[model samples]
Target: MAASRRLTQFALVMTVAAALAAAGCASGLGGGTYQRTEARRTMTVQFGTVESVRPVLLEGTKTPVGAGAGAAVGGLAGSTIGHGRGAAAGAILGAVAGGLAGAAIEEGVTRRQGVEITVRLEGGSYLAVVQEDEGEQFRPGERVRLLRDGGTTRVTR
Candidate 1:
């Protein structure tokens, strides 16, 4: 009986964690039109020569998904462990631990490495653009297009 209860709780916790992760993935996408904070304008295209290419790791930002999931799971598991006062204490500890673990997991999942391409424009000026390395590698001295749209910019072949 006790073993079955423990198994059920464990499964519930796992389900909650999976749901939280899926939620994160779903909310990550933004609708197109334009963001209120983003600059509104047409893309300004310019030709440039790649001056350098360097690899870089982009840090991930934390969200409540992990902590929230962790807390719910921890609280549930903790509730099963003790009597009234002890149960409360266990829940608190579990929540803190779960939150920390969730945050770490989120960071790990979202973190990515990319490349910074430094391009020297026709007038001898330099600009660097960092983007996801989608296998479209850029080499020094290679010709490319720099597209600037409002406050955002991108480099392409």
Candidate 2:
């Protein structure tokens, strides 16, 4: 009877973990992508030539979702480990471990390969922009346009 109960709890925990993993996968950070709020907003256009392009990594979004999901799953799984006080201790430890693991997993899953583009504007000032790689390669001396919307900017052909 106890074994059967433990098995069921383990399965439930696994199901939750799978769902959380799927939820962590988000949209791209490419140059072409924009947030919903950015639509229809006017952007300042600046012409420039690419001075250099370097590879980079864009970090993932840090939210409470991952940690919360992990904690719930871990607590449930750990509660099955022992009875009474032992189970309580296990649950606490498991939640801590799960929260850290979930955060790391979320970050690794959302991490993207990006590029740092150095551009020399027509006004003679130099600027560097980093954006997720969207198969649009920028080479040194290539002409491009910089679109600035407040604090945000994007480079395009």
Candidate 3:
């Protein structure tokens, strides 16, 4: 039972890691790149304050190992309470109950929450970025400038 629980935990961690890797790959492909220009330029930038922060809940799927481990542990515990056929039957019933409880607990704990930030670009483009850090804050109508290879992307208030 202990071995099964350990394996289940490892599998869950691996699955989550894979999903995070995939998401990172996807994001790396999406951000646009700025080319360096020969000319020098200055620009004014505008910023927007975060009106609201929303947590995005990612749905998680179930793993059979979690249930199996739960059942095994439950059965073992249940078997200790009775004798003969009663003990055997109790173990089976306990295993089923434990499996369900384990599954529910795993599901609840593995859920991930992401923060979405809405920013207004200077050129009137609205950009939303999902970030793991929720403590970062940007004020609305703030002026900011980015110096890139001579060309500047400015956000003006």
Candidate 4:
């Protein structure tokens, strides 16, 4: 019975880890989204001088992937604590705790901090945009380009 229970626990852990691994891989951890289409669209490019740079945080969304994966792993972990009724109770409690932790962990992992750049266009228009920092820093008086395609715009240096 003990051996059988241990085997079950191992299987549960492996399954949970495999499932969560896929979710983790699919997660937008780098913090950017881009839509691609085969149709060619005219892109509008404009040059501007940066006026100011301010730090900003891009919040991450909550998803069931984290909670579900966590609960499964936690339940298996908890089941090992005791036998019979005690084990059953442990698994239940563990699942609840694990789910919460997993969600919080996912949010933290996906959250990203970037800079919001304010720029003055040549036509005397002011535009503020946020772009992911690729280890590059932006400051006042920096020359940048705004590329607009369809309804999306990206500020690049």
Candidate 5:
């Protein structure tokens, strides 16, 4: 009975160890036997020059109008503070303050337009390039090179 009990305990321990080892192996802990892939891509890019620059106004912006209205209200309040000469001085000061506030509000709502470049790819596909600051310098109808990697992804030129 004693020998049989000892054998059973040993068997249980061995089974537990084997399970733990198998779990570790499956989780990529036993050895680094994982495959690595290279980052490869292919893309076509066209170059173009900046034709025009403009302000891209933000939508749903009420800053400028709100500022103007707020200014008017402030001016009216100031004008109320003084009689005659004081009222006139307050009105002038209020107008100046309102104009500055309105300008600031408008500036916040305005975004600078990016340069637009037009390019044609090999399959006659046209692409429009819009970039901030520096854009690809290619003239209209100028020949440009397009590069593609294995996966045929487009990269910036």
Candidate 6:
């Protein structure tokens, strides 16, 4: 009976952990992509010439979901190793280690390669925009377009 209960608990913990991870999946930040809310909204357009393009790393999100799921799974696995006080100590250690690993994995999975494009507008002013690379290449002196929606701006050829 005790073994059956433990198995059930383990299954439940795994299910919950998978659900949390799926919920935290990151969305694309590419130039061609648009969020649902951004559709049908008017954006101001401006013309520019690309002055420079540099590679960048876009950082991933840091959220509680990953840490929480890891801790729960680790604690459950640790508790099965010993009895009473020993089990408690093992759970604590396991949870700390699991939480750290989970956070690192989450960040690594969502990290993306990006580009910083510097442009000189028609008015002799310079502006820079960073966006996910998405296989789009830019060169110095190439003509580009800048689209602005509220505080967000993107560069496109």
**Order of candidates by lDDT, top first?**
2, 6, 4, 1, 3, 5
How much is 28 displaced in model 4, in angstroms? 6.2
Runs of candidate 5 exceeding 4 Å displacement: 1-67, 110-120, 123-128, 131-157
Q: Tens digits of per-residue lDDT for model 3 on 1-157?
A: 6785577557546654544443333211111323354235453334554444455664444666556656766676666556899989988898889789766655555454555546655566766655443333435444433222333332212
Local distance difference test, each candidate: 0.74, 0.83, 0.52, 0.75, 0.45, 0.82
Tell me the number of clashing residue pairs for each predicted model: 0, 0, 12, 0, 7, 0
C-alpha RMSD in Å of predicted model 3 compared with the true structure: 10.7
For 1-157, candidate 1 gives per-residue lDDT tens digits of 6886888587766857684565456222111223455555567888999999998886665777766776777776776668899979988988788778777777777766678999999988999988766667889989999887757677888
Candidate 1: regions farther than 4 A off: 1-20, 23-41
Candidate 5, after superposition: displacement of residue 19 in Å? Answer: 71
Q: How many backbone clashes can be found in candidate 4?
A: 0
Candidate 1, residue 25: Cα displacement in angstroms equals 2.3
As a TM-score, model 3 comes out at: 0.45
Q: Return the lDDT, model 4, position 145.
A: 86
Winner on TM-score (5 vs 6)? 6
TM-score of 6: 0.87
- Model 3 misplaced stretches (Cα beyond 4 Å): 1-52, 56-61, 120-134, 137-157
**Comparing candidate 1 with candidate 2, which one achieves the higher lDDT?**
2
**Candidate 5 lDDT over residue span 56-99, tens digit each:** 32322334453554355446545655789998888778766755
Better of 1 and 6 by TM-score: 6
The predicted structure with the larger TM-score, 1 or 3, is: 1
> Evaluated with lDDT, which candidate comes out highest?
2
Tell me how far the alpha carbon of residue 123 in candidate 5 is from the true structure, in angstroms, after superposition: 7.8
